[model samples]
Target: MAEPGDTSVLATAKAKSQKSHELASCVIKEPLFSYAHLQVLNGNPLQEPIELDALQVRSYCTAALQQFLGIAGTAISIDILKVDGSDCWLRVPRDSLGAFSAAITAWRGTNENGVHTTFRVKGCSDWLGSLVGQVGQDTLWSK
Candidate 1:
């Protein structure tokens, strides 16, 4: 025997629950990855030299490329400079050119076709992207 104007307590609660869920969804950030931030950078290698642990950095680079751009196995040679931690250098196939470089991205190094392109990647802004400590030169052994 509810009054005509009376609101159903259960209905009001369900509506509030749905609203709370929507608010929660907004708070959950999806991994920040967008093709809009990627591009093939064209230029000379920067004045800064590539450093040690190039292999490791390249690994991160590869994963990021695959995760963000859907490219894999495109990398060719990765050299660890060993002079400085952050100065690692990489060389991949020229075909990979379009795959690695992003205008919003910074790609550096040579390609397999002997066409070299060096650019720096701005820090990756994704849940999986991370900067591991550089591989120091003291530990590098060139082939």
Candidate 2:
């Protein structure tokens, strides 16, 4: 049996407690990227469905950035993660999320073939999983 004043047992207990605490707490230091879920919309409800390709997505984003922030804004890197129908997923630098979002929001949509199209930012998150979960919820509620 251990004595009440046993320093070795006390140190062992302290070490085990510290390890458990460390395991329970997680600190994500400076996440490198942020994610956004966007949907394309057209002004006319009677128009055909919009199908976005990678090139079109990039062009639209570039135009918005250039319009909002000029050359500097155009320099912001945007990664197209996935494109499905009218919806797209994008990854951008964590530092530029605000500027990117603002650019998309403020720009007037482009008109092509009498169809006016614009991007709507459905959601944004530093963690992609959160944005993905939100998308799932949106689908659930939408149906």
Candidate 3:
């Protein structure tokens, strides 16, 4: 029989096995998505304002993605979180954030006046609440 203070051969082997597993195992990172806050603007400053609802915003975004990324762009998913006036809040895959933003900038939106418009990305974050709590552009001028 082994002494009280002595560990058994099985115990030593089990400890070594656990140590090996701890060393060999790698920490996996959780996938994240970036939430983008976009503002639709009239490209032609001279043209009247073009107000858009949730559907119209999605439609315009779809068109932009189609124009910039072709058929593949359509595969990218977009969730419209909210729409207030000309401002829009949306979410896109974090990995695709760059491509999505680039596509929006590259494409031009046409207003009811037959004039082109632009999509301005005001802010982007992985957390939805962060975007919601952010200050508006007006805050830039505040003391």
Candidate 4:
């Protein structure tokens, strides 16, 4: 039997207290916005690569929404996070992801200067970090 003043008992209690203090966690069941990784594609792969600016991205998304859902779709908020080459990142209300995805997928692409352009959703997640890398690469197995 261990005595009330036993050093081992006190040490064990201290260790448990320290362990609890060392660990912290926060769980968000529902995020306010979801992120999407979009790739802009043209009809011809051999054509010059498309470099999209913020304005162009907004215009494309807005046009898609407008065409799909009319005035209501146009009101859906879209935030463009980054645009590199033909890839773009966007954030939209968590509840509106389905509508947004449908809009982009179904809309016929626009033709400008004989170049046809459209958006494709590569991946989407409530957490942005999950969509950061190459869309299909398994990060765990990659060097």
Question: TM-score of each candidate?
Answer: 0.30, 0.82, 0.69, 0.81
**Which has the better lDDT: candidate 1, or candidate 2?**
2
lDDT of 3: 0.81
Better candidate by lDDT, 2 or 4? 2
Q: What ranking of all candidate models by lDDT puts the best one first?
A: 2, 4, 3, 1
Q: What's each prediction's clash count?
A: 16, 0, 1, 0
Residue-level lDDT tens digits of model 3 in 1-143? 76777778779868877843444766537446778888888767786666769998898889989999999998899999889888898889988888888888887767665766778878887778888888475587895
Tens-place lDDT per residue, model 2, 46-104, is: 87769999999999999999999999999999999999999999999999999999999
Off by over 4 Å in 2: 1-4, 9-26, 139-143
Against the true structure, candidate 4 reaches a TM-score of 0.81
What is the Cα-based TM-score of model 2?
0.82
How would you encode candidate 1's per-residue C-alpha lDDT over 24-47 as one tens digit per residue?
434535432321111123344453
Q: Quote the lDDT for 94 in model 4.
A: 99
The lDDT, on a scale of 0 to 1, for candidate 4 is 0.90
* Model 4 lDDT per residue over 78-122, tens place: 999999888899999999999999999997989998889999889
Top lDDT prediction, candidate number: 2
